[model samples]
Target: MSDSKKADQKKAIVFLCDGTEEMEFTITVDVLRRAKVDVTVVGVNIAKEFALCSRGVKITPDEKFSESLSSGNYDAVVIPGGNGTASILGDHEGAKKLILEFYESKKIVAFICAGTLVAEKAGIPHKHTVTSYPAFKSELEKVYNYSEDRVVVDENVITSRGPGTTFLFALTIVEKLLNVKTVNSLKNEMLTCSSL
Candidate 1:
C-alpha cells in the first residue's frame, strides 16, 4: 500500500516492555483510541505474553516483537517512558529496527520520558526540538535538540516529558496523525481543552 493509504488509517503501535511506565503507556493508547486510531500495544519482550509496568500493572501485548516487526503497516510507533526503556535499548533489536523503519519511512516515531533514550539508541537523529524527563536533560541533549517543553514535535519525531505530561503528549500525537480539529474536539469532549 501507498504511504498515504497507510497514513489514512491512523494506525499506531505503542511499544511496551517490562518496566514501562503504566500511565504513559496507557494514556497514549487511550487518547489515540479516543481519536479513533487503531492502536496495537506490542511487547518488546518476546518471553513474556504481558509486560509488568513500572507501577506494577501487567499489560498484555496485542502483538509480539516479531509480529510487529513483520507487520510494517503502522503509521506511528509510540514509546512510553519508564525504567524499562533501558531494557528496550539493550534487549530489543526488534523495537529498535521498528523505530528506524518508522523514521526512514517518514512516519511518526514518538516517545516520552525515558523512552527518548530508546529512540536515541534506535538511531533516529533528533534534528529539532525534543523533550524528556528532566533528570535526563543532559543525556537527551546528546542526541536531540533537547528542551524543557512539556511536549515537543519536530519533524516526524514527537516527545514529551514524564508521566505528568502523558495527556498532552497523546493529544499532540492525535494532532499530528489526525488533525487539530480532532484534537480540539476530543479536548472539548474530555473537558481538558479549557483546563489545559
Candidate 2:
C-alpha cells in the first residue's frame, strides 16, 4: 500500500482496561476487523501490556492508551463491560476526556453491558437512546431513553445489553462506520441471524 493510502485507511481502537469482559471485547474487535477496519486494541492502563479479562483471559494489546490518545486519529473507540469499567473509565479523567473528545468530534463511541455507564460518565447526552444490563436499567431509564432491544444506536453512540448481544452491537457499529450495505453483506457471509 502507498503511504498516503495506508494513512487513509479507516482505523479503530478497542480500549482494554483490566478485567474487561472478554467475549464482548473480542467479538467487537473480531467483527470490526472483519469489516476491514484497521483496529488497534489499546490497553487503557499504560503501565500494563496485557489486560486479564473478567473471564480470566489475558489480552495483549496492540498499542498503549497513551499513544492512541495522543495520536488522535482513530475513527472510533470501542469499550467492553466489566466491574473494572467503573474504576477505569467512570472515575478516570483521561478515559472521560478521550471519550468526550470522540463524541464531541462526532466519532462513534460504543459500549456494551455495564460499559454504558462509562459513556454516561463521559457526558453522553441523556436524550440519546441506549441499553445496558438489566441491573442498570432503572438508573439508565432515568438518564436516557432505555431500550430492551439487544442493540441501541442513537446519534453517534451505540450500546447494547451484554454478551448475548455482542455480535449485533458490533454489526451496528460496522454499519455506522461503513454502511448498511457492508454490514448486510458481512452478516450474510457470517450467517448472522439478523441485520441492522
Residue runs of model 2 more than 4 Å from their true location after superposition: 3-5, 46-48, 67-72
**TM match of model 1 to true structure:** 0.90
Best by lDDT: 2
lDDT of 2: 0.84
TM-score on alpha carbons, each prediction:
0.90, 0.91
How well does candidate 1 score on lDDT at residue 144? 73
lDDT of 2 by residue, 1-196 (tens): 6888788777887888888898999989988988888998877763467888888888899876672473268888788888786458788777788888888888999989989989888888887999998998888898888999899888889999999999999998998888889898888988888744
lDDT of 2 at 85: 63
lDDT of candidate model 1 versus the reference: 0.83
Question: What does candidate 1's lDDT look like per residue over 27-97, in tens digits?
Answer: 89999999989898877763577888898898898977673364367789898899786566545676787
